[model samples]
Target: MSGKGDCYDNAVMESFFGTLKNEWVHHQQYQSRYQARSDIFKYIEGFYNTVRLHSSLGYMSPNEFEAKYHDNP
Candidate 1:
C-alpha cells in the first residue's frame, strides 16, 4: 500500500487508466451505460491484458509476462 498523498503508490493504476483512455475510451462512442461497460470489459480482457505490449514488462503483454513467469517458476 502507498502512503497518504503519495503518487508513487498509485502510479501503476494511473498508468493503466491512462492507457485505457488513450487506446480505447477516447476512440469509442457508446449508446448506453450497459454498452460502455460491456465494451470496456472486453477491451480490458481481450486486448489490454492479452495483446497490448507493455514497455515495463519488457515489451510483453501482461498475459505473456505471467505465462513466462509461471513457466520458469
Candidate 2:
C-alpha cells in the first residue's frame, strides 16, 4: 500500500479514470449501476482498447501500437 497523501502513487490511474469519465461515462445515462458497469467494461475492453486513438501514441489505437511494437521487435 502507498503512504498517506502520496498523490504520485496513483497519478497515472487517476488520470485514466478522469479521462474515462470525461470522455465516456459523463455522456451516458444508465438505468442501473450494473448497466453502467457493463457498458464501461465494454467501452474500455472492446472499444477503447481496440479502436480509440491515443494522441500520446501518435494517434494509434492501443491495439495498433502493441501490434506494431511486437512486429518490429
Candidate 3:
C-alpha cells in the first residue's frame, strides 16, 4: 500500500484528473453514469494513452515512445 496525505504523493494523479476533466469530461454530456464511465475509459485508454501526443514524452504518442524505448534498450 502507498503512504497517504502528501501533496507530492498525489501530484501526478491530480494532474491527470485535471487534464481529463478539462479536456474531455467537461466537454461531454452523458445520459447516464454508465455512459460517462464508458466514454472516460475509452478516452483515456484508447485515445490518450495510445494515440495522443504527450508533450512530456517529447510530443510523441505514448505507444511510439514505449516501442522505441524497448527496441533501443
Candidate 4:
C-alpha cells in the first residue's frame, strides 16, 4: 500500500530482515534452501515472536504484548 518511490514503505521489513540477518543468518552456513527455510521458521516462531523482547512493544515479546491486551476469551 505504499506510494511509488516512497522511502519509508520498506522501513519495517528492512528492520526485520536486518535483525534476522544479524541475529540468526550471519552465524550459520546452510547447505540447502529447505534447511534455510526451516531454520528461519524456527527462529521466528520459537524465539523472535515468543521470546525476543522488542522495545517497540514495551520490552515485551510479541506473544506477551498480545496476551497482555487481548486476554479475553
Candidate 5:
C-alpha cells in the first residue's frame, strides 16, 4: 500500500483507464447498461489483452507478455 498523497500508487490504473476512454469509450454509444458492459468486456478481453501492443511491454500485447513470462519462468 502507498502512503497519503502518493499518485504513483495508482498511476498504472489511471493510465489504463485513460487509454480505454481514448481508444474505445468516447467513440461509442450505449443503448443499454448490459450492452455497454458486454462491449467493454469484449474490448478488454478480446482485443486489449490479446491484440493491442503496449509500449511498456516492449510493444507486445498482454497475452504475448504473459506467455513469454510463463515459458521462461
Candidate 6:
C-alpha cells in the first residue's frame, strides 16, 4: 500500500465516511453516545448493507453482492 499509485489507501474509508456524514450523520443531533451508536448501527445494517447501491460493487448493495458471490462460488 506504500508503493506508487497507492497513495489512496484510505480513499475507500474516506469516501464511506463522507457518504455516512452526508447522508446520515449531518441530519441528526444525538443526545447520547449509545443512541448515536444504535441508530448508526441500524442505518448500516438495515439500510446501508441491504439497500444502498455501491458504485464500486457495480451498483449492488453489500448484501446483494455477498449473495451473488455465495451463489456462484
User: Each model's TM-score?
Assistant: 0.76, 0.81, 0.82, 0.81, 0.77, 0.75
| lDDT of model 2, residue 68 | 99
Question: Residue-pair clashes per candidate, as listed?
Answer: 0, 0, 0, 0, 0, 0
Question: Order the candidates by TM-score, highest first — what do you get?
Answer: 3, 2, 4, 5, 1, 6
What would the per-residue lDDT of candidate 3 be over residues 1-73, giving only the tens digit for each residue? 3578776778888999999999999999999999999999999999999988989999999999999999999
Task: Write candidate 5's Cα lDDT for 1-73 as tens digits.
Answer: 9988788889989899999999999999999999999999999999998989999899999889999999999
Q: After superposing candidate 2 on the true structure, give the runs of residues whose Cα lies further than 4 Å from its correct spot.
A: none
Scored against the true structure, residue 1 in model 1 reaches a CA lDDT of: 80
Those runs of model 1 whose alpha carbons end farther than 4 Å from true positions after fitting are 1-9
Residue pairs with backbone overlap in model 4:
none
Question: How far is each candidate from the true structure, as Cα RMSD in Å?
Answer: 2.4, 2.1, 2.6, 2.5, 2.4, 3.4
Alpha-carbon error at 57 in model 5, in Å?
1.4
Q: Itemize residue pairs with steric clashes in candidate 1.
A: none
| Backbone clash tally (model 3) | 0
Q: Put down candidate 6 lDDT per residue, 5-43, tens digits, no spaces.
A: 674877878788889999999999999999999999999
Assess each prediction's global lDDT (C-alpha) against the native: 0.92, 0.93, 0.94, 0.94, 0.95, 0.90
4 against 5, candidate with superior TM-score: 4
Per-residue lDDT for 1-73 in model 4, tens only? Answer: 8897786889989899999999999999999999999999999999998989999999999898889889874
Cα error of candidate 1 at position 59, Å: 0.3
The residue pairs in collision within model 5 are none
Model 4 off-target regions past 4 Å?
1-7, 71-73
TM-score of 3: 0.82
